[model samples]
Target chain A: MTLLAGHPTKVGRLAFVDQDYPIVLPVNFRVHRGSVVFRSDTGSKYMAAAMGQKVAFEVDDVDEAWQEGWSVLIQGMCHEITDPHQLKLIDGIGLNAWAGANMHTLEILHHRITGRRIV
Target chain B: MTLLAGHPTKVGRLAFVDQDYPIVLPVNFRVHRGSVVFRSDTGSKYMAAAMGQKVAFEVDDVDEAWQEGWSVLIQGMCHEITDPHQLKLIDGIGLNAWAGANMHTLEILHHRITGRRIV
Candidate 1:
């Protein structure tokens, strides 16, 4: 397993399974202190995490010309950010959420992070 | 829920779980006949899917300058492509693999696809 060298892009995919179906969606994100952070509406993702769901966050890149790129995967426990200090700090980061205007902050506490780069 | 207008980028993330750990990773892909396709080595993803695991594939784009983008997610059943005709057809597509040299083709039989655009 190769360790990712730098910061992950602010955009990536969040994956979780609800019932028997897998749920995967793109999320605008940030990595703060080894956790994956993003925003979600008062919908499936938020409700799942609020119920102490485990989730996966992944990001990858590819160059069609070079035919190479890398993929990173992180597994963690998800929860809503209610701590005032953390919320205030993230508020300062101002991750631009494009999908919904009233989305809430969700954080994935990292349990294992593993990645492999083809480039 | 909005329908995606065009082709998803050739790269995205694949999310699944094993032993209760959420696993998300980037994958080089192609959309053919309304399904998500990619490649993987003889690893966790492959082993898990070989056992009939359901998976999620997602892709999105973000423009930092505009602070707008779109994300798409597809839920599906994953399987190795063994049909010669299908493999030959996909061979012509030639989706590139960058991170690993000895990767094998894996395709997601999409069951549900949903997206939201922030732009």
Candidate 2:
């Protein structure tokens, strides 16, 4: 499967560009209508992910017992969402923002999502 | 502290440029000589991280009960290690490669490693 199937944490990462260097951050994200969404604050990661910047999101899981795992890499354009209507949609998903009561939602959309599993 | 003091996993991520779109991948990595190292195969992620590519590596952890967490972002250059002496040193570090005897070690070195913890 091009996407992870039947996995629990659904944890992914966000990567953006800052002064010719790439910055990577681990984020708790969810899949929404073929798009990846997460929560961020006015931090360095959030700042670098200015609207329209090319970015990436990745998710992976490892089964220690089985000694096998799968990884998915998603490359897309970063979009900041401030629409109340859209925010309401993601609010229902219940994100573990870990930020004290003030978090902003961001989304990344791409044409294709790629994944690989070593079984 | 910019680095995780007591987090057990010590896992980080690697981000690289793949034809203009950044690609992020979660990897079980370790910090050595102030550098981030991980095991990779001859895959897309490995291919793109050839020689000296400006990349980023990150690590983060969350305590669900504490409702707080910390994240570290590392930006650096990707260097592939084929030297037997270096490979032997990394092998002694005990990495859970999860690959079938054919994985290669790659290291990303950076001048500065940055992290933030939300309490």
Candidate 3:
């Protein structure tokens, strides 16, 4: 199994603006070709991708017991994978659709990633 | 210790618009009088609160072992607690400043909270 096959903290929050409302929703994601990829089923996230919106995705590992953690934030443009060749390539990336069935693949492209450690 | 004193997942992602991009940042938060409260220094979050921006906050409890979790989403207006009396009252809420010091208190007011379980 690849390290991401069953990664415990694979879930992160995807943020985007929908009609002037800033929204954040948790998503299961994986890294592919230096971008964040996830599956969504015609939801807000999917709509954001379809609209080619700029978004922020955040993932963190924290030990609340010790009050410490590090977080990585990525800002990028969302793109829905539609090309058959690319979709087939992404299918081999070992990412699962943990959210639901009938999903579409989306990736955050041109990522500007940053991380901070809270010690 | 109240349930939140050492809650393992008390940290959540606070989302709001900065410029034209939607951004989400991890925050250690607690519920105070039906509002979500956290401490932040002068940063993007602080500016959002000062502007009374409408924002969304998301917190989730996930079990990657079982691929199940529940997330609560909150939509509200961010308020910076500047009133001396209110600040003094919030000081006793027991929510630690897990990130850093010299923090200012902010709360999401008029919460419209909703939750969903993923199985």
Best by TM-score: 3
- Can you write out model 1's per-residue Cα lDDT over A5-37, one digit (the tens) per residue? 243456666767687766777667776565767
**Could you tell me the lDDT of residue A61 within candidate 2?**
75
Error of 1 at A17 (Å): 1.5
**Which TM-score value belongs to model 2?**
0.83
Please list all clashing residue pairs in model 2, or write none if there are none: none
Please provide, for model 3 over A1-119, each residue's C-alpha lDDT reduced to its tens digit, 9 standing for 90 to 100: 13333446688788887766776788888777667788877664435443588898888877666878777777888887788897788788666665566367888885577777889
What lDDT does the true structure give each of the candidates? Answer: 0.67, 0.69, 0.73
Would candidate 1 be rated incorrect, acceptable, medium or high by CAPRI criteria?
medium
Q: Estimate how well candidate 1 is docked, as a DockQ score.
A: 0.62
* CA deviation > 4 Å runs, candidate 1: A1-9, A43-51, B1-8, B43-51
lDDT of 3 by residue, B1-119 (tens): 13333346688888887766666788888777667888886554435443588898888877755778777777878877788887777788666665767457888885577777779
Off by over 4 Å in 3: A1-7, A43-50, B1-7, B43-50
Name model 2 segments beyond 4 Å from true: A1-7, A42-45, A64-66, B1-7, B43-45, B48-50
Residue B73, candidate 2: C-alpha displacement in angstroms: 1.4
What's the distance in Å from true for residue A85, model 1? 2.5
**Candidate number with the higher lDDT (1 or 2):** 2
Per-residue lDDT tens digits for candidate 1, residues B30-56, read: 766667767666554434543357877
Top candidate when judged by DockQ against the true structure: 3
